[model samples]
Target chain A: MPNTFAVPDYFVSPTLLTRARTIAQEHASLAKRLATDYDVSAARRLGELQSTSTAVREYDEAHSALEELQSLLTSTDQELRELAEEDIQPTRDRIEQASAALKSSLVPVHPFAHLPCLVEIRPGAGGDEAAIFAGDLVRMYKGYCARVGLRSTQLKYDTADEPTHVQEAVLEVDSPGSYGMLRCEAGVHRVQRVPATESKGRTHTSAASVLVLPSIPTEGGGDMGEASFDDPKSDYYVDPKEVKLEVMRAGGAGGQHVNKTESAVRLTHLPTNIVVAMQDSRSQLANREKAWQLLRSRIAQLRREEREEEIAKLRRGAGAGKVGRENKVRTYNWGQQRVSDHRSGLDVRNLDNVMEGGEALERIMQSVRTWMAEQEVLSLVAEEENSQAQKK
Target chain B: MPRLAPSLLRQARAIDVLLPPLLPACRDLRSAENELRWLKDHAIKTGRQCGLAHSDASLKRLVARRARGEPIQYILGTEYFGDLELKCQPGVLIPRQETAASVTHLAQQLSKKRKGRPSDLHILDLCSGSGCIPLLFHHEFYAQPGNEHCKLHMVGADISVQALELARRNQKSQIAAQSKRVTAQTTSLAAMRFLHADVLLSEAANAIHAPIGVVEALQQLTNTRPTPAYEVLISNPPYISSQAFRTTTARSVRNFEPKLALVPDNPSSAPSALDGDVFYPRLLALADQLRTEIILFEVADIDQAQRVATLLARQSTWRTVEIWRDEPGATSDEADHVLLDGGESVPVRGAGNGRSVFAYRGAAAAWLQ
Candidate 1:
């Protein structure tokens, strides 16, 4: 039987109700604009304009604005949903008395918010047994992905020899709630078990580390525009002496043409000693443009790194050194069949069920959210104390 | 002015006459001439001067072997890299030109970095194969001033015993040829040891056959040194992707090398069971633990290089990853900005050639941070 759960009455606090009304009105306005203003005829004309020189800029600007508006609507909807949940949680006991719901639906917010997490799990010092445990940890993740209905994509993977053991594997899990849920899964995971390959069933210790990154929206993705590059209004010329351009015939996997022509252009920035080559393009101009694109991205990446460093420095001053430090996070001991998240201080004994994912993940996710809420409260209290001290 | 000696001209003529039959199919006149000159010089130095006709026959056989897809070095039984004559064996991956470039880079860096001109530097070469890397380093470092006091305590590790034996032979021949050079050293024996070890093995016992003391010494040198045990960590491990193994033409695959070295053994293993790129991660982990100051890893192409850069960027420890090309005169920070998929120009750094990842640990972090 599917258990039914109701949203509690206290969840509908006055502040939350006002916020929800404002969000609904904004969403309605966006819906109206999307329907009436964004007509099929205009879209077709816009597509045509996109291909033409005269109207292309206008078309692009319009498209960007539309995208921004749509994102705004989506964000507003998300915020309203979170507010609803906050209001509902206060009346949790009343909701439980109301109905038994099999599928518990809380607003599924993207879990990796606010905190950048580091996951580290390595095969412990125990030889093949350690390696084997590393392999199991990787599988446990895959199983966890399935349970959470998350998709696991290989960011990188390294395979061992015959009698297969995973030397190392890094996987990126895509889910709304992954970063928050997997944050609990960082640090040294120790495994104690008899190797399947061993004749004498002797227990050995192994370890693996997992790092979770809350996939931040890129610079221009949302309201986080601080890191986005402001395009220089004026054209800047690279000193002729500073730039070295070499034309070469591109090689590898590409066809005979790859070896035939000097289509590939290698640009060397002498000042920075950075070299970018683009041979994938058919023409030299295209290749140069491609190379420039790569260069810009790198510069942008550097800027992003600088911003992160500054924020980290500030955080250190604020006495939250342990929050973002890439040291210890979590541990999984296969011998004990236990997984522990050091940050939240939560331990789950059912390794198999957790690895398999789903309901097991829900419990872990709840624990993480509670931890996050407590941290927020602590931060608020600290701020209040600082203000009070200033007045005194 | 020194004129061309008649005897030298005569030998050159003899080598020239023998070269045609040796390289009948080869069209590059310059390459053929270079080969002949090299071989003739070797023959004359060894005092095993051959008649013009006999030299022709030998050259022809060597050329024929090359034409039949055998590496020229393997056919000749030797190849000179740096100052060492390394043995080239069948089934072993030949030392590549890019590898030579990286070795030279490391040697130059090490010479500049090390203090007091120490008589010997402890160096470990994993996946040593024919021990070309250690041999080159030994030859170069020994030739430097104050290096006479410098003993090169070198260890070459490889899982293949056959390869290890071949490497040992190569080292022996090199040491014998340079015995006079070796005698200039004042320190204890310039120890050169080979241990059969699989880097992939989590346990040392699964791989190494050395005595406990030796093992402990090596481990200590690797871990506890005020400076890293090895001034430089260099490896050209099997980096061929599984996709390449599966999809490469038969001419390149079946005709050239062993599948064991090229592809991961079990293709059908679960995603969790297999690491797609095995050597790179292991090297990274080793670097992390051993804290080796410098690492030079050979990769296939730009895509792999980019993947490595991304992998390194994700790590807290690794920083300042710059790719190098096979070509000379390549700079590390040569930025050529081009637009990306979103039409944004990104700065390109390093040798924009066949992909090679050259990164330093603390330096890059310090620079960027």
Candidate 2:
């Protein structure tokens, strides 16, 4: 693997660090209580003594209580540590961006904060090779998920016919900081090798694109102003006359009905010509509610796209063509056995090890943390300069 | 239950008389009464059975044993398992009621599904601790009053020689009981055999070899086959995780069990080994090779069950998997703890949620298609 980048070190704010230290101290106290008061020590002693029946029963109960307490403490400690580590920066540009946000009095928002992430992998220009590469990418992400204790659920997939494997697959991974870690996975991944189906020893190049979308929060409206919801501006509605509601027997992935009755409902929005389907509910009403939420998210996404276009048109006069353009995040060269992330300018030489899902990814996560810290510091400098100018 | 013997009842009354003045812990009247009754009966019965005369010394010793928390069954030297009396020892695991229920369920299913006479049946019991499973099957089907034509061929395998010996003794006792019941017209025949083999070990290397005694016994029972395969395979293997062992109460780990019978024999030294639950993968591999029609294995909990089911579903061999929990008797507190894949809680019918058993059947290609 390539050597990880070592950016300038930054310390978290003293207030946050102190809070984390207090939390850790509280956890130590709780652990001591669990070991002493819960009879964990007593249980170990009784096991040695081969004690009376009452003693044995007491020991079992005490041990279980201690185990539960320990698990709770570990989870709490992890949360505290993440919060403490939130104050670092490694780059001047990111620091300046943070300073600007603070100057504008805008609340800081994580790109994928508090939302389940949707990861999409699709074959690009490379035909069968791209599809096969996409399949490999899914496995890599799944392995990464296992390492991080994230819960991954396969949302949907389209398998290639006979000769090739998976053409496209989508997964929803739920965990703390999952989207922030996986956002770098977006863009095209390239693979070069002789295809197994190809008889000749000629090398072929294939490409697959990954799209990571933070799940739209249904409860918290995301930048959707009042105008988007008002009925006046080209209102779109599902025509009841043209719409059809179908209930069918639904089963798990293997396609056999787990239940005898047709409780699943599929709703087709007539005006936008969009179909929303849901089946994992016991009652029809529950299924309908799920379908409606999905429909709302779809409509919101369309409205957001239109709003972005209008904003871009207005920004054109400002002559800031480079503004708002996201970077080409990462590239994997299979033949050279190397992976390069343009954002951090870090290169990992062992592509196989990185693809196998190991510590190589942690290097990237640490760099992101450092970059975020740098952004904060630059913002602080900009604010200081602006205040001085105002005073003069 | 029968009332206590008169002499035993008198001894109990005496204990109750002395307890109030001596120990304040025994001040509770109902608790004192219960202690007295338990001590009196336990002393009288175990003393007589162990060939000790009905003397004051014997009574005191028996009472001391009871107070020390030794299981009553161990003091008695025998416990009833099905229709046979099994020799109970300190090292051997006790024959649980839930296991008995599992066996009964399997037998009922087999009887309902199978056609023709219940003869020519082949059964294999792995991890056959005291051979109670095969012996019970024999007693139920072969030694029954009217079931004469049933020809049962049973092979019980365990890794421990001591356990296998105890199993043999239990089998012999059952056979002796059968011969006594048989009249001049009917002839009693041997139907069960015991073997000592470590199923976890690879057969290529003789690292953990099957005991010669067990091998010979199996050959005799099978009439010359070195290895006897069966249609029905059942095992209650060690499924506890190493992490569970570390945090588990000493009552489970140190006092009541043997480590060899509880923990996996070997764990791969890999980073992912912590996540890899061992027994399921090995058991499934064995099932694939054996191609047994029916296989049942006990697991720790519902999470293990789901993971096992997932592993089996990935393979081509097994088609149907169903989880079976032991129904706790009427006296047990009713609480459901089994969790389904979709995060719904379902009732596990055993003593605890952890003791539930799972059953899987090999799927035919026609069924899949």
Candidate 3:
């Protein structure tokens, strides 16, 4: 609803672009300072300054070339304009590539950017239909994952009391660095449709809340990537003393009552009051491990948001509709047979196709990615502003 | 993705035996080319037996056998399951892709269970034709870096002495041809004990046609006076209907595979499913006696799964009975759903088309009587 899917040139914050010149200037001064001092502190400062300087130079070179080529497009001379037109595509590509490299160097890395992701979806409001729509959301994401070549493992899926419909589900995207791409998918999604079970053909509004968290690397088991879960400095690390563990019989659907023993493990983080229940595993130990993982990820995400609060303005009003957590980010309306992503304001008319994660879904995801990158640029811009203010 | 080479295509054309189509079925052109490399290796190794070393003849013979409905694994001598290559021979059933999938699913479940547990574990493989299940588990358990010290004492019980012998050889060969993935671990292969006992009879030795002195045989293999309590019981027990085997089963399987491995030998008084699901009830009873935590069985299909679920429900010994799909990574939601108390329906959560049933004892919640 914010409709912030600006053009590529304007998407990056102006402050970051201006800060490139400043970073270049600082690097020059730092190099001189290092040469004069030749101390450990100056040498370390130089080490950090070196990459920043290179990235700034790279961004400036591409940005300037793009600006020059763009100006030539309006040249009076016909031959020059034709030359500009011919070179425009290549020059734009170079700028985009350089900016990507520059952005990676400039922006502070999200602590969990390289970790895998877990997506938990639950019905928020709208009763039985909401649960049914939640199931649909699960299918949509699963389809999207398939199209994107991201492997999703169903960690837990609970059907509604009706037995035929799904109520809540958790799917783990196992691909490394999936968290960076999927993190912004958290928040609320709204749907408006006539309930199939309704006899009166009344349109009912429903919502599903999606929470995306970074999955901890399974200690010593599971997939290849080995990530630390015990290091205090690591974002994913959780203090065992702060957690309260409980094991009970795994409940809900088919997994229930199958184990004559108590196999389900639930972890409550005393500090955060965050509760995570895991019973999919038959062994209590397995359940405990999974529950601990879920708890760690939740706490880590909360920690990230606490840090993100300082630059929360970078994400200001990205979602327009004030329906649920951080505004309803997307709406799927069956009456209009359309899916509208609020941040990008991308309206794809084919609801079925969007739900299937077809071309329509791809278009929305790509635009959202662009918007997220712009937000990162804005955050970098804010960081530069803070440092500049301090210096002044 | 390489296209089939023109020369290879020409060579396939020249060869009279029907190996061309079979090669591509294994993989794309690259797979066919790889098989060609294996054929060449076989050819260069021996020239005496049936002129195997005379390159072209060896390829022709290999193809001819496959073309005549012999399983490619049998002819190839090894089937790769997980990271291990199980030696396949006649009489013993070849390790199927479905079987490999079942092993993978079971191992993942067990790996989670093995967290901070005892290093030494015992497993029983009923109707373990090729000893693939235990051997595959042996490899999977030691696959991780820190679990190198984990030891698995595996028992493979089958009535056929031929199958038992092949199973033993598979155990030796799999241990010898250690997978590079598991070389990070120094754990030896599971200590194997091949039991020549029929599960149907009261006495283990009496179950078999020939008296192999069951207790003596088991002792000789295990070197343990009394068998330890098995933690896991796994089987790919035969569940095919007589009619399906006679009519619906694949021509190659019907023609070549041992009938003893595919069908219940004497089925007139068979206990369940009206066809031959006698093994399901027997295995459940056996599981009750063993008090095994996990029981995994490969079924014929969803229909057989339904029949087995009914048996588990009737037996009322276990807490949860789940139908698992055999295809890797496929969601349990896509698999068949079984109705529980209060008319709740839930899919057996795991990968594949739900061709297997994974039942473990949960807090003894009573099933519908």
Candidate 4:
């Protein structure tokens, strides 16, 4: 069979190899330090570098094997030359696999990659039809999580008057590292189908936006040092002063005089004007805690995106333009029964399988993840080229 | 109360037949919906556990009980105080968010002062309703990594036997919930005790059988502290005056919560102060007797907080005194100060109505500052 997994005619870039070597060296020193005296940040960094160091080792071994095989190709014996030639192709293929792994491992790991995520789905366009599609997407995600054996909870599901219509829904994928696996599903998703609300039998275009955020634990999980709110340098660290907390309590005496059960809590990050309101839990304390968590996740995501935008501007790949939240990442065409990922350019004919979050959905997500890693490598190459040009 | 709109009631009824019954107490559609959801969840869980009749029937009954102005905490039998969920009964006052906020703020300050150094700490809560204050304090303080090493002794005293019983039940449930997170070796539940005592009556005024004073009762209950000098004294005592209870208290509170927890008995007997203000003098005297370093007393509003602060100032015992608003940590633009009858004034921290009077003396002066 043809090796479809192989990147066609791929070669390892010198800049990427140099980056990988430095990472391997850092990993070695971190491992030594970790053995003698343990530190949380040091351990976490070491974990991130594990894959990069492995890939570097594999690449080095494959390159040496290929060179050894090439040297034997020059043997005076005809039998030896033929054997060396036959083995060279396989060794070269091994080298190509290592190169691809090395390239992907160099892409910076997302800071929130280890955390469980909150997937928020909101209708973007096409009014009522968009709302219906948003509902479908919510179910699709829930189905995906169930199929994958990931624990999921619907944090907030606001439904409209019509059946199968949703205003907004937030699904908390409660499995750790789900953020890393599901983050590529973010951005606008466009859908084309004949809506139930439609009078005419014509296909119409609608869109819904998906936002995935890290669900940071509230207390005692302080081991997530950088993600914990106590650290001022952490993106999750929100100044208590900047937040405005509103409780829906009766105006009269609050303590013993009132027995009101209104437990809704709203927190607004005043600087960014990001508001998170939670009334899902009957306990006021629980609602307040959930609100604070949602607020922190959103603020952290915003801050990280802002930093990414600055880096992307510097990297500036011409063909690799940034596909942000506004850009359509995937399309679901009901008429053609096709689900297409815009970035990966992968299309699946089984619409039912995609909507059911079956193998087709997994295939699309895997393609997008690969496409994202390639984009990261392209940006790294672009950065190297920019710096070299400046040196000239 | 004004009548709920027909349209709103219909809307609630449309949501769930049980939801409309909650609208009168909840006063709005959103809260009614929330209460109904919680009630339904409570019904199913408890019914299934106890093997009771249908949860749907129980849900209808719970909705009816809520409509008649019963506190949801009492109906559900649990209320969240800080991170600890305390069991609630009708007689014991439900733990308030304001009280939790003050307790949390104090715990944060205490932990910050400890700075990983372990030391013996004792807390006394007067008129402890569901034992919420001390249990919450223990939860917050021991949440820090090094605090489990520190010897924590807590005493919660209430006049009513029912309150004390609920307090002990709350402690058991808290320990059960806490044991899942922490190892048994470091559990401070042993050091915590609940006693039945009336703060208003002096030891001389009461019979030998009935414990009247906090310090005397605590010494009788525990062997570790024969004469305990607590580090902190906290209380959310019955502070609402008889007139306020009649004029200002909510219908749910007036109709359902224990009257012993809401209004102090016999205002005419306490000649010097308002009926609600009667508890402060007794608590202050107890604080002095116990040699309590820090005291936090919950009040009705700014006026009451000022009155309590003035009472504390008259003794010149505390090094520093501050009144904290509903949210003690929140920043505000307005100048926060409560003007006393004297030319001097005390600083008020945070925003909203002044909810607590916080004072620290001796070693605690340095900790709070």
Candidate 5:
């Protein structure tokens, strides 16, 4: 059954073709009965025919068209041959497009697609360069958000020990559906650039990781279509008992005021170990509130990822192993001025423009979206084949 | 300093005497633990240069002082105020979170005009200790893109020469360290500098208005007042009354930080409750003298802020005298005549509990609307 619905590769599954043929034949008889007897029951049966088996009707129409075209190909006249040659391609394309559209529609929409997102960027390997690159990525996102009419706010910006680079940053892109748009950006982003600290001209590899999570309200992931973190009823709500809160003076820096004032709050979810430390606010309460909001989003993201993994494992067996396939997504090479997205396997030049978050960045994101759609369609087709095979 | 090495965290954990255990509250223990981690990191970094023994002795002294309630900022000799990492010294009071918040709010309102600022934006910070307010504002303003062309002419004015020297040192280090981080490369020709001037004196106030004693402040001071009718006037002036400072203020602050930066000067032998508010009228007079439009002051608390607003109401200089707060009030805009700016938008700096007073005219005057 898994290989049965490999459409056209094996002339559609015999079982599926037979099913469609049976439906078509049944529909023909019901139509004929309704025309002759003129009974309401017969008419109703005929009316529901297309709805019951869409594939059968489409196959019926295309089969008949192909039969007529096959006959035309055998005609002696040159004009008839030419006409068949021209008409055959478009008809086939129409059927393919229609079938794909139908197959894709069968798959449910991603649950978190409509929700806004928070993107957490952190340094991975390369020391100062990695931190600088992380900061660069933050700027790029903020610029891109500005260009796209999305309000991007920095919730937390942890300065590095080096002081020049940001150690960590959380940006909330406050537009609905940004999660779907930015989720593809999750994974490690590699940068190849000659360090300013480097004396000799040589390229060094550095990496920054982007973790995109749906911006759930800290209180509740409400059914009201609005997420609030304060709502105990919210799916995002972390039980107070489950979280350990820690308050410290703002990092050892920021003068005596930052040192004496215990303003920084860190929230550690016991089960998940997802810790969100916030010290930007001078007040402990404010910091705690921010930490909760971040923790909720992160935990919600973690759960969503787990769910995706489950779906991925199913899709891999049922269709293709695209889910849980890859993580290293993109690379920014400064010397060559190239940005290559591994997901789409697209190598785009103008690294600076991409860093500026211009059209090149959009193009790369669009390619990721297109690639995602194809994977989704493939998985949906596979799932349909599995279900249909089991019925057989 | 060195990303708080594991050894440092372990070291802080081992100590029970100097590093007190934080309460379960998320705000308490983390900072103390964090500072120890940084101190260890700094110690390691210093050790790299001067050997372990040299680092050990100095670190021991710093740690011992911290145990005795000396601020870690003074020990580390550095502070991150907003976007800028300013140099900290003993005489100059460290920049408060309340000041950082008030300055942030001020910068946002001023930068709303963005690129097409009529001319250069002139800001004057009175009682500017460590020059943290103006220094941070300069750095934060330029940190964002599209602010490359924003000519932010800044002046940090203080009465204490020590503060002025410390402010200059902060200015120098900030430029040295954060020059690459921000857009304003060298901070224009004479944009960022410190000046010595007492706001309490009309003689010093006249120094800015007429061509009188401002020359002396200029001959002596590197920074001066700019021409375009000072649009923004900000201060974290001393507002703590003697009674409140004695009771409410922390022992760490009382023992270490300068008193000049926290409380007002006594005009008479016996200081009254009104003595704390002496700067509000002087600042009001200075604002009136210079035609300063937007004004923000960091008061001790909401009650003191309310009194400042009342004092502001007496004068016709300001059209709106609003108190921006973080706490949830009964209403959005209050009957108390203080406008509530920045509702849930930008986080307010006060004590994280609404306490700063803002008096203004011109575009920024209409905060709530």
Candidate 6:
């Protein structure tokens, strides 16, 4: 590939540059509107676009600095050329940083990115071994949360007949901005290992699917603008009529007659057929509240993905060979003591470190996050390119 | 109760050693596992607070108590009612979720109708076991940002001294918890009180006639000059019929919970009263004497709710009577009206089997909207 001075390896493409500039313009207009009217949603949108605008300004300065360095590089004087040579590499680095920032800033932030998240893990394939792998994944995520200093609570942990096997589990990472951090972990995770239950030494393949959903704020919504449950237009809003609640009180009379400790609560979104059952807490009220919160998060995530899919369809081939929830995004090979992320194509030899949610797991997660950001940027560029083509 | 299968016990054993003990009370492997997990978590939490040895001892004691079919609320020492957690004792009736849901719905309605207006509102809770109804109502009502300026005088009355004591304790703790969260608004938690009163004798009692009447008790507790008229009268009195108590009531409830809070004490005295319908007539008479604007009576089921609603309607004091279900906020696809014994029909609200009978006077009919 021929190296171009204008478009470096980390530099933003023409389409992405225009996208960033447009976002900056939008931010400016929103700020002006907010100054006069003080609309809440508009102000929120302005806050969201703040980083992109800042990135655009930084990229422009870096571009100007590079142009100045380029002029100095073409100077006749040997001293000026040498001086420029020294600053040229650092200027290129600055450009690279600015462009990278600008590109990511152009990628739309997830609506629930600032909220805490729930990580749901369920066995996917290979029966009892898969259940055991699911248990491993649960511990791995829990360990990762601990190492990263994120407060995590096991919202629901159901165990199979086997002590070591996990029927299903939900781990709540109770910290803001966790959705942004752990959303990349949502997909099938395959493990190649010899089962403890296996009589023979033959290696077996098993899988566990991980789902990351934003945990809606219980009381004060914090910064969760339209995601408020009361807002009918909000993705979090499920019409009360659309949901069927089942309290696991034994058949017959309720109230004081039943001192039954079965405080399980199940909520099924009728339209979506998404059922969320919670029995963790002894209080039925608490369980119901938690069930609703989980149900809303799941519905919100589903709605967001559906909208994204529609947009992705419009910009087809932009996310070519992209790993979805159905695809195995990662694999932990116990035989080779390796952990690999398929999307980012990163492989590490330290299996124990990954299982411990150590530096190796962080590296893999970071790589996947970067890969996801790149995908978003590519699709954004494709969208802009198509719109521009239509203008022609 | 049906005997637990050996397989279920085996599964419970697989989950945890403590789980099999909870299987008796929990009645299933899943809930048993959940209870065990909660108990273990509670133990660990207590271990952090106190020593690990103390935690283990308490966990074992709690598991043993639960195995004997004691309510977890009693073992845990607290029960959540709406947003507030009330102290639960053995003799005091544990706050039921259906009651919480009804109270929450009523509070929401009252606050919504009030619309940030500062006004004196008095609520009378008859048979207020654990003082869950009034405290929950206060918590749910005052939680709305603008409602802090509103003057709330709530009195929870119960026949049992233990129930009254528990109710007062719940009120004090809740008031302390709420005072910390009180904004710039001057909210008074002092107005809420609990008193001893036999609501069964409410028919013959009046402010002047009987010193222990519901009205006189309200006056003594609230100390309002000229005796304030209650805006809302709410109760979750014992409504289960004696036969139903023997046949339909859960064994755990029969074993552990207080019968004083489950079945009305006497059914022979009132000629017109069925065993379960005994409390309604007395509560209605009390409501009429107090001139309470709204009344919410928690019933055992639809049949009981109908009986109460019919009784309230026959008095001619209430303008409209409605039946509410387990979840009063939930939407239902069923018919909005349930036909009474007479040709007249009453509007029904929410979902599940009818849980509460709601009736309001003409003055407070607007609040129902």
Error of 4 at B225 (Å): 14
Ranking by DockQ: 6, 4, 5, 3, 1, 2
Q: Model 6 over residues A179-217: C-alpha lDDT tens digits?
A: 899999999999998998889998999899999988888
The TM-score values for the models, in the order shown, are: 0.39, 0.39, 0.47, 0.77, 0.50, 0.80
TM-score of chain B of each: 0.68, 0.71, 0.78, 0.92, 0.77, 0.90
**Per-residue alpha-carbon lDDT of candidate 3 for residues B320-346, written as tens digits (9 for 90 to 100):** 677776553344356457675435454
Candidate 2 residue B235 C-alpha distance from true site, Å: 1.1
lDDT of 1 by residue, B270-369 (tens): 3522333677777777666556656777666555556666666667465455555554335655444333334323334445454456666664233222
RMSD of each: 29.3, 32.1, 16.8, 6.8, 16.9, 6.1
DockQ of 3: 0.02
Model 3 misplaced stretches (Cα beyond 4 Å):
A1-14, A26-105, A220-227, A249-262, A310-325, B1-369
Candidate 4: deviation at residue A259, Å?
2.5
The lDDT leader among the candidates is 4
Better of 3 and 4 by lDDT: 4
Off by over 4 Å in 5: A1-259, A263-275, A278-392, B1-29, B53-58, B113-117, B143-147, B178-190, B204-228, B269-271, B326-351, B362-369
DockQ of 4: 0.37
On lDDT, the stronger of 2 and 3 is 3
lDDT of each: 0.52, 0.53, 0.67, 0.83, 0.67, 0.81
Q: Model 1: which docking level applies?
A: incorrect
Local accuracy of candidate 5 as per-residue lDDT tens digits, B1-369: 124445444544454334542211113344555565567778878788775655766666667777677766787777656445667888788776546656666666555655435446767788888888887777666655566776877777888889888888777776666445434445542357677676766663433443233234543554445523566788888877777677666667778888888778666453655466778877877777667777888776566666677767667566666676532221233333433232212223222345577766765455423
Q: Candidate 2 chain B: worst 10 consecutive residues by lDDT?
A: B21-30
Q: What are the clash counts of all predictions, listed in order?
A: 69, 12, 19, 0, 18, 0
| DockQ of each candidate, alpha-carbon based | 0.01, 0.01, 0.02, 0.37, 0.05, 0.42
- Best candidate, TM-score: 6
| Candidate 3 displacement at residue A160 in angstroms | 2.1
| Among all candidates shown, the one with the greatest DockQ | 6
Model 4, A91-164: lDDT tens digits are: 87888888888887888776778889999999998999999999999989999999999889998877664436
Superposition TM-score, candidate 2 onto the true structure: 0.39
What would you estimate as the lDDT of candidate 6? 0.81
Q: Pick the winner on TM-score between candidates 1 and 4.
A: 4
Candidate 3 chain B worst ten-residue window by lDDT: B360-369
